[model samples]
Target: MEESMRECMRKLALWHTRTFKPIMTHDELEPIMATLGFLGLPPSASPGGSLAWKEYAHSSSSSSASSGGGGRARPRLPYPRIDGLHSYTYQAFVDGVSSYLEMCDISVLFHIRGMPLHRLDLYKKWRRMQEDESVFVYREGTLDQATYNLYHLHRRGGGGSNSGDGDYINVKMYYGSGDGNGSLVIRDKGNSAPVSCLVPLKDIIL
Candidate 1:
């Protein structure tokens, strides 16, 4: 049941990710390109579509064939695409940005640092999610900070955030090929008894 639930969440995040409008192609952005051409400036480093590809590929069968065969595969987008994912739209749904979520998809979740998102090469990612992403975050800070502060606030001992709600877990999928994943745990990070924040999205028949 837990496995199925995780898969469902992964798909939900992916389905949500694919629903958005894709990158705009070069032709669709012509007015901007024209202005760039006038100023003797290059177009967008990586405009969305096939035209952007042709620009770098140099079209082996066309007039630029002479250059295509010998030249390096240069990026046409001026800047790297990795630099473009900083916006909120690209944040994980767990982070409160539901639009272009990349976090929970199993292919992206089990391992860390997958890039170009479209390319799903499993071997490329070396670290497991738990190792890098499992640190708990509380409201304004981390689970460690929140709990420690709450402890002090109660005893009149130290400054605290005054609360212990785990809002927004940086969720990730667990994949074990069946070994380490089965290792059960009694406590979460910060050495505190774990709290289960998961809520059922929908259900019935109690």
Candidate 2:
């Protein structure tokens, strides 16, 4: 089972590199390509079938020659940032493709990711409910700082005090919305007002 899972992940990674890399615009692909390069893999070719490696190599050689033929300095690669795509959408795409290749249900991806069996069951149940009405359930102390920042930014104005009590905020998910794009809600235990945060589906972890 472990070996099979690894193979699925490998195929998924390769598909992401080959399929999305060529089509994404420079601004969209920059971070992903940088991550691939940092992992000692070749960055994807551009839509025109050209890679920037030649230019980078040329600049490195020129710098080495100018410094009296010392060994060429490595070019600095850009760091990957998660800002362009919606997390849930990306994960769903990956899960869908992987499910197709593995000949398994999408829930298998969630199971492999360590999501609780009960939460999975609950989500499945929620899918069959009415569109306007929904269920909200949450786990306490699950809010990470990065995700909190996303919530904070979405709220726009804030004067909420930060707590250092080692107690993190609650993370909630709303299901059965009209659009079916459920929301992530965050709130301090002491505060009655909660902020609706847009978090990546994978980040929910349960």
Candidate 3:
């Protein structure tokens, strides 16, 4: 059992060094806290809203498993620190980190295009497209109405038509006479006309 435990620790350390270390940035304390939480480890407060791991295994193992036995009692996990720090369970940590990463990726996409980060559906669609390379070409005037409709459907929590609704942004493409030249007509719902003039394809980022 001792050997097995050592092996487990060894593997975990190796995995951390190989996978986690490469991706971790110096400023990513939240991600470190999140990773510890996902491993069911306790966290103590640190500088700059960061968290540090607290060794709790010894204490947890020493706790009583039974009081007077009306039923089989279990040891209680430690509570969050008294300093009003954020604490999380394994699943909660995973969820929070996943959400944060998704938002970060979405932000990068919007930043690349110099677009405002106002549309949740658009972000979702972009993420999906990233995962599936065959979905759509990443170029100007490649964003079609179908993709927008799909984005809208997903944003509405997946139970709707492809038709225009008040919740979706509508985009139209216009091709110019010159090769590789086009413009986009963008309009939001509940608007009488296009909100902006035709934007040139070359001006947009992928």
Query: Per-residue lDDT for 1-206 in model 1, tens only?
Result: 83332222211011111222223333332333233221112333232322212222222223334232334222132111221211111122112111112123222221111112222322222211122222111111111223234333442442211111111222222222322111111224354333343322121101
Off by over 4 Å in 3: 1-5, 8-90, 100-206
What pairs collide in candidate 3? Answer: none
Error of 1 at 93 (Å): 9.3
lDDT of each residue in 1-206, candidate 3, tens digit only: 73332222100000122232311122233344344332223344433433343322212223232221233122111133211111112112222332323332221111011112222323221211222222221222223343345444443553222211111123332222222112234545468465645432223223
**What lDDT, from 0 to 1, does candidate 2 have?**
0.27
- In candidate 3, what residue range of length 10 has the lowest lDDT sum? 6-15
TM-score for all models, in order of appearance: 0.17, 0.18, 0.16
Tens digits of per-residue lDDT for model 2 on 1-206?
83332222100011132232221233443344344231122333323433222112222234324221144223222122211222232233333233223323222222111111232332221120112211221222222234446434533443221210111124322222332222334444567565544443234323
lDDT of each: 0.23, 0.27, 0.25
Runs of candidate 1 exceeding 4 Å displacement: 1-120, 132-206
Clashing pairs in 1: 45-77, 45-78, 46-77
